[model samples]
Target: MLRWTVSSTDSFLIGYNDLDNEDNWVEADGTQHSYSRWRSSEPNGGVLENAVMMYARDADDWIDVNVESSRQFICKADIGASAIPQPTVNPSCSNGWESNGGSCYYFSSDQKTYSQAQTQCKSMDSDLITIDSEAEWNYTLGYIRYRYYTRDYWVGLTDIGVEGTWVWENGGKEPTGTYHWLAGAPDNSGGSEHCARLDRYNGYQDASCDGAIYYICEDDLYISDAPRSIQTTIQSTTSAVITWTTPLQMDSQNADLIGYKFYYWIRNKQSETTQSVTISSPDTFELVFDSLSPGTTYEFYMTGYNSYGEGVASDPPGNFTTVSAQLRSENYALNIYRIAKGVYLQSHVIFSTEAITLQHCTNICTGVLSCQSVNFHHKATTRAKTCEINEGTRESYSSDVVSDSDYIYAGL
Candidate 1:
């Protein structure tokens, strides 16, 4: 939510202007001021989810506000808003790039080859644009719409010169963050033009730079680097699993998560520290550090990353208890059985000692958290024989479940 304050300045623009500590300021043009008086709710400009709005702070329930509503808002106190510091904005101010408050941007039109269009943008003193955040993207969208281009234009990004090697004309190349591919498109058709274009989708696709496509210009925020998040788990005292989610609003929408790195430390029986563990991946993850010294403690957390940057690591989530394992939380019952190494739970056996069946085995495994694979012992002929439980072979599928009518085993 946007926070507004009546500035000490006596000018009529008083409350509309917002000042940054570095002296950079974003003045709210009468948009909010006029709307606040008549609109039922505060306005919201967030790109993804719509912001919640209420007429008054003391209101019991909040309501959805229009993008144009005006309301005295509260900013998140803990995170606080980041100020965009003033910098040498794109100097070719007169070029196609639009400068709203201070930054500059180039709108695009699909036309010309990649090299040729870049040369054109350079003539304007700006290279192709690199968008990093949703704010920048929102600004670009409006800026592009404001341009008088008849069609989409090529921007600074493309993979035409080298197949599969996408790079910016302004810098060393590689794609960052997750991407949306145009539907059945960007085949680099005919292999003649490798230029790219940015369309309404906020997605990019290769096109003939000279194709007269519309473009976007940019004056960037000097964000040094986004924080990185790292996660680790330890099956220590009580087999604690610690997961830390970062505080940054990264690709929270489409998720640009590269993977999580985990760190864990355990103590030996002598009270000495064990080797720390590190793990990484580009997907949801789970790690268990088993065989911990009972009654010991462990610490761990998770961090996220993409090509653009990594988010801050969450604070350590820790667990203590080396031996006591609690099962059956959330109303789920758990069953742990001692099994023979190499023998799988090929099938399920009834308490009455009936033959094993596939339906029963899968159900049993699904009910238990520790179980990953399941097998039913269907071949056993003895209805009185009790099924055997054993460790499953790691690399191969489960073989036949042991079943023999001759063996009359007793059930517990």
Candidate 2:
């Protein structure tokens, strides 16, 4: 529900629905009002009108007239009641880069191999620039024409993983219907070219991966600059509310922004993986993440997006932990060993520990929310030296024969 307020000295249209009688005036919700704003000569209509319109001459000036009467009205938006609070607008780019299309681009001056160039970009938390549209391609071309007309620059396009299956370094499939390759380009010249390069000379072409070349790096603008004053509230043991301030200008002049993306993960499990939530709305600056692990600290970061692309990610403002959930019977289930000899669960390991007793191993498996089984192994040099805690139920295990008795498998 939203609330509206009248300006101090501005006339406006309100949700009043009643006959001309000031005695019957009420708000849209049928709430009775003790206050009156009628002008000295207002409500002159005798049972012939049923509408109210404020006048700008004075703060309390109002006039009652025919329902069909027309007049200019002032409009106001309530910030406190907005579904997503209005974010303070602020946008920026990192040093030595220019912002465009919701992203930032850096044209390197030095040359390096395709792999090395990619590594350099990664070191900056960016990647080799990938042109997803003709506009972006033209933008890059314009930059090259102005500053590096004849110089070759590396792009993120490649077919290195599989011949003839081109993909962007960002993990997107090759674009179709609008290829910008030069005549007879990407012919896999010399049977060794697997990387792609861009220049004014020949739009784009395949080159040797080991070939040294300058490269461009693309960083999402919103993600890099990020929103400010991020505030988070723990809603429950499994949910939290996150809010941030972004100035209206954070949106492109055309309001190309489409949404904000939230990336979060448990602090200890960050290296393994992260989860994401995308709230699609140019104006939505607030979000709620649910079904999160309880009693564990979580780190959160955000980035804004538009039709063009995603902006730079905001530095993680801080961390928040949900309240612990009430303990349940399943959480206290006994860790009874299930015997499965000569077989080891494959590719299910979530964690591993060294030199722990079988009893301790069982306890470890039970303690983890995802662990349902454990694999204990002993090498010739050290007896029971390793334990592999695995996810997934025992029923889903695919057994692989391991003749070594020192390698034992158990599930709880």
TM per model? 0.30, 0.36
- How close to the true structure is residue 23 of candidate 2, measured as C-alpha lDDT? 47
Alpha-carbon runs more than 4 Å astray in model 1: 1-96, 100-102, 108-112, 145-150, 172-179, 217-412
| Alpha-carbon lDDT of model 2 | 0.68
Clashes of 2: 16
TM-score, cand. 2 vs. native: 0.36
Per-residue C-alpha lDDT of model 1 across residues 1-412, encoded as one tens digit per residue: 1114343321111132211111112223223333233133332222221334433323233333222334456432236656656655455355544565334665554455556666665565456675545565556554443333124556666775677677665444645344534565566677755666766444566665556554554433221122233344432233344444332323221144555555455523324553444445554444555445554555444445444344444454443445443334453433332223234334432121122454444333333234444333445564422333223322333354444433322111
Query: Which candidate number has the best TM-score?
Result: 2
Model 1 residue 323 lDDT?
42
